[model samples]
Target: MKRNICWIVLLLVLAGCSSPPPIPYEAPTLSFTLNLPDYADESVKNSELQDALVQRGLVLDRFGRIVPLDEGSCLYPIATRTALLKELEQYQSSSFGYTLVSLKKQGDDYFFFPNDSRSQTLESLTLSFDSVLFDLTSIDKGTLVRDWTTHFAYLDQTLLVTGEQHKLLKKKHLSFALRNILIVTGQRASTVGELSMQFVDAIDTTRFLVLTHGDVLRSCQALTQGTMISTPTEPYSRESIKSQVKLVSLLPADADFNQLKQQQSLLSTGRYLTYRGDIATLIDRCSAGQGQSNQALCHSKADDSSARKKKVIVFGGKHGA
Candidate 1:
């Protein structure tokens, strides 16, 4: 009797339950535009700088998307990476004082001699950090490596001699310190593995170096470049840099036109990437040489837009190194 009563209740409950609504499906459409900063363009020309950028995976299409273009069939990723690195170099140099200390393009990997001795000092500091802090490996291997080092050094006289005042330094300088760690370590990491792997290796290596180096006067050529150029006085704005980087190309990634258009709606929105200078000079130069529409002025349109289009202007932040 109890079993029968339970079955009747279950049937009533089952009959009362309603079916769920179907999920709506929309096509996955990609839509975004990206550009290279001025320095990234220049760095692409330098084989060494290009390698550094490739290692970091910063070289992407106009949409800020990375697509490995290793084969000869596709060179857009290669070109985009090279160009973006060149453009980024300006900001790196101006903001952080990175100079072309030395650049040499090896076979697939480029060997860079940044001329900054922070690596040496970091090597030493890593040793010191190892000495003072116990069980630091937990944080050392983790993302906190950079943060801990900056905090530890600022609190302790790790970077300065015993007599020097550590309290005077603000924590803000830690970011710069962290940047130095990345550059030095990232350069070293670029040597052992593929481009992307190398970038990570460099970062990992920097953690060890930052921990080991105690207080040493490292080479400041990179830093000096910033000072000489008065980069700090002008200061590089991250937002402005991001904006300028967004303007390099309409379709900056590694994809066919259809693929790129599918990824970026602006490409289909009737936008083109053109250099203002190129457009301004195209008419005069074309009239003097070739008057055909299919000739000089034709290529002058930025990417695909006409010269008269209202443009988003970007200012060069600084000129360091």
Candidate 2:
């Protein structure tokens, strides 16, 4: 997040005695002052009007971190209005805008409208406690979407989004999104994840895939404590192999391999499989067992080693590892 010291300085400049003088008061437990006047929207001062800004997580301090309390919300600086407007204009250079029309929120159910119009909605559809804001919509309703104008400093205007409904807004997706914005703003891919080790390459926004494993995993781990990311790699392959390929031995203890079997059946019927989605086939292909007892053992150390060698030769070492 970018910091604008101008807000603090502007507050100092404006601090002084009024005609009748102001009532003295201590700072609130939670407080924030806005740094940009033009964008802060003075109309927000109305006591009776309620804005979705807070619920949507739009409240921010000059430092760009979310302000948790009402007292922390402040107006953008009046002095910097011109500069703020200029920045906003630059941010709004693109003609496209997005309107997110969400379905009514129940206890925890979430839903979004599938529309071909420029507008789209993000629903909070969670099926289980582990589900993170998952939802679904028909693909035909997808339309062209762009980054939020209010978040320009954190993203770029050139970053385009394909119309698709997704359940998990995983950190990898957010990181890639940030990288696209930074690339458009001419900044180095701001290092993502807690440790800030994984750097995204901003060549084409559309071509950039999210980082879910390896360095990406390290980055996410660094950012938040007790966060575990899925790291199953290359589970399926279409190419016939003369040698074997390595599979991750450390599977999640509670992982639903049964759920995987269901997906595998779907893949066999017609669904596409990423390398991570082909676990059963990859294991079967790399093993030598024919009987139930032999298959229970799954593979031998020698087979595992051969598979690693084949993977290094076929998919290249960087990702195969």
Candidate 3:
């Protein structure tokens, strides 16, 4: 994922952000809980369901939510926003994964809308949590068949979403949906148990896949503990930061999106994406200016065209403001 950070920075910058103050943002917690529908079994509750999840390569995190253990049956992807988006973009770029719709969360469920980078016009669908995995298209079929502008989502747009909805996914981070074949039908319990090690990538809070081997049950604990980052702290170098900040936005079209799905390569890739996301955050501050609270303004996508081009620092590994 470190190797791919260069491209991701570009993707985010190119993707853009909207207007907001430079005040510090408490990192959004990606921790989630699986909400069982009325029809699913009720017996998989509390300890009984927890025990079943444990048998199936899962464990309760410190936050008391169920997360995947690093065993051969499940994977837990923990990374920052930049790395996660890059992995999502690169997964498709490397011919390993493809971008599904960005997720729109309403109440307990997530709906799919076309917000992919290529900006294609595609079909919309809803996603639901079955005990073990996510179903890409919903029986509900097409969602809110309305104006296209309302459906298209972007990562940094924060504004009021009006009328008729409970809650919409305001932050435009990527959602990694399941299409990988490692956890297959019929051989599900057996094949999936063995294929967990190869998992790469993740699903955002919406449509997170939770597999319950023994259970009715259903949980994020990984994130950097920091506030308002500007430059590399004592241990790191400016040279490393600049190289990562430069965006090299090209990705191969030949790769299939499936390669990064369902235990494809290594969790190390997910870690790499998180690293990039943190660096992306760092650049937002460093470019805003050293020690100035408004330094985050340097990278805000909502800024005008001239502002977008005025990055305070230069890249290609040189170190000077």
Query: Taking the tens digit of each residue's C-alpha lDDT, what string does model 2 give over 123-165?
Result: 1111111111111121221221122222222422223222231
Across 1-321, the per-residue lDDT of candidate 1 in tens digits comes to 999999999998887685455555534433333333333333343433233223322333332332221212121101111112333333332211111122222332212223332222333334433212111222222233334444344432212111111112233333324222222223433111111212211222322222111100011111122121100001122222222222222222221212233323333333322111011111122123534552333344323332121234444343333
lDDT for position 23 in model 2: 52
Clashes of each: 44, 18, 18
Question: Where does model 3 exceed 4 Å of error?
Answer: 1-60, 63-140, 144-148, 155-321
Instruction: Report the Cα lDDT for residue 190, model 1.
Output: 19
Best by TM-score: 1
Residue 50 of candidate 1: its Cα lDDT?
31
> Against the unseen true structure, what C-alpha lDDT does each candidate score?
0.26, 0.26, 0.26
- Candidate 1 positional error at 181, Å: 11
Q: 239, model 1: CA deviation in Å?
A: 40
| Candidate 3: Cα lDDT at 54 | 30
How do the residues 144-214 of candidate 3 rate in per-residue lDDT, one tens digit apiece?
22321353232121111211221122122223122331121222222221222112222223322222222
Global lDDT of model 2: 0.26
